[model samples]
Target: MPGDALVHRINRIQGQLEALKRIVTSGEADCVKTIELAKAASNAIKKFAQAYVETHLDQCIEEKVAVKELHGEMRKVVHSSFSL
Candidate 1:
């Protein structure tokens, strides 16, 4: 349930951000529309980061409880997502 909820939330935010990007570059809207879309994109990015951090914390707890070092194993995903 937690994983599903996390993934669903992230996906929805991603979709919204993508749509907003399209609107920003659609060339059919005014500056107000672009500004609003940019704000939406910023909010979506924040939400996505929060959701991902929560999910990662959950994963770390589950791994520690299970006596497994999944944190080290997930370096690729972590780096790709959190690093520039």
Candidate 2:
């Protein structure tokens, strides 16, 4: 069920990407429209990444830290998830 939800989110992102591609290829998008589309795509990507981190990585880190109080491992998880 969780995987299905994740897949649905990914599909929505893909649709946003396709919309962005259409805007670029249509050649009718003005500067404002282009910027708007780009921003929308960027926001979608950010939301997806944030959801992934919160849903998957956070749970994994919590599980690991609970099993063994590995502060360094938890820090590494946080760094890797948030880092570009």
Candidate 3:
């Protein structure tokens, strides 16, 4: 059920991104509207990433920590995810 909710959110984000693309390609959206759509899409992506990290990465790290396996690989993964 939670995964289904996440997939639904991801699909919604995809639709938002497609709408933003259409706005850019159609050349009908004004600067303000374009900016608003872009910001919304960006925020959605950030929220999804945050959710993924919280749900998946946190659990993974917790598991590793329990086994004293937290290492450079985990740091690299987190750094790369944020660096984008």
What are the per-residue Cα lDDT tens digits for candidate 3 across 1-84?
767767877998999989988988897988998898889888888888777777787677767864445787677777987795
Q: Find the candidate with the highest lDDT and give its number.
A: 3
lDDT of 2 by residue, 26-81 (tens): 98778897788788878877787777777787676667755556677767777986
- Estimate TM-scores for all models: 0.51, 0.63, 0.75
Q: Enumerate clash totals for all models, in the order shown.
A: 0, 0, 0
Per residue, candidate 1 scores C-alpha lDDT tens digits across 1-84 of 767876777787778777776776786767786677778767777776777677687766675664346666567566876776
Task: Give stretches of model 2 more than 4 Å off.
Answer: 62-84
lDDT of 1 at 81: 69
As a whole number from 0 to 100, the lDDT of residue 69 in candidate 3 is 57
lDDT of 3 at 23: 86
lDDT of 3 at 2: 61
Model 1 CA deviation exceeding 4 Å by range = 61-84
Model 2: number of backbone collisions = 0
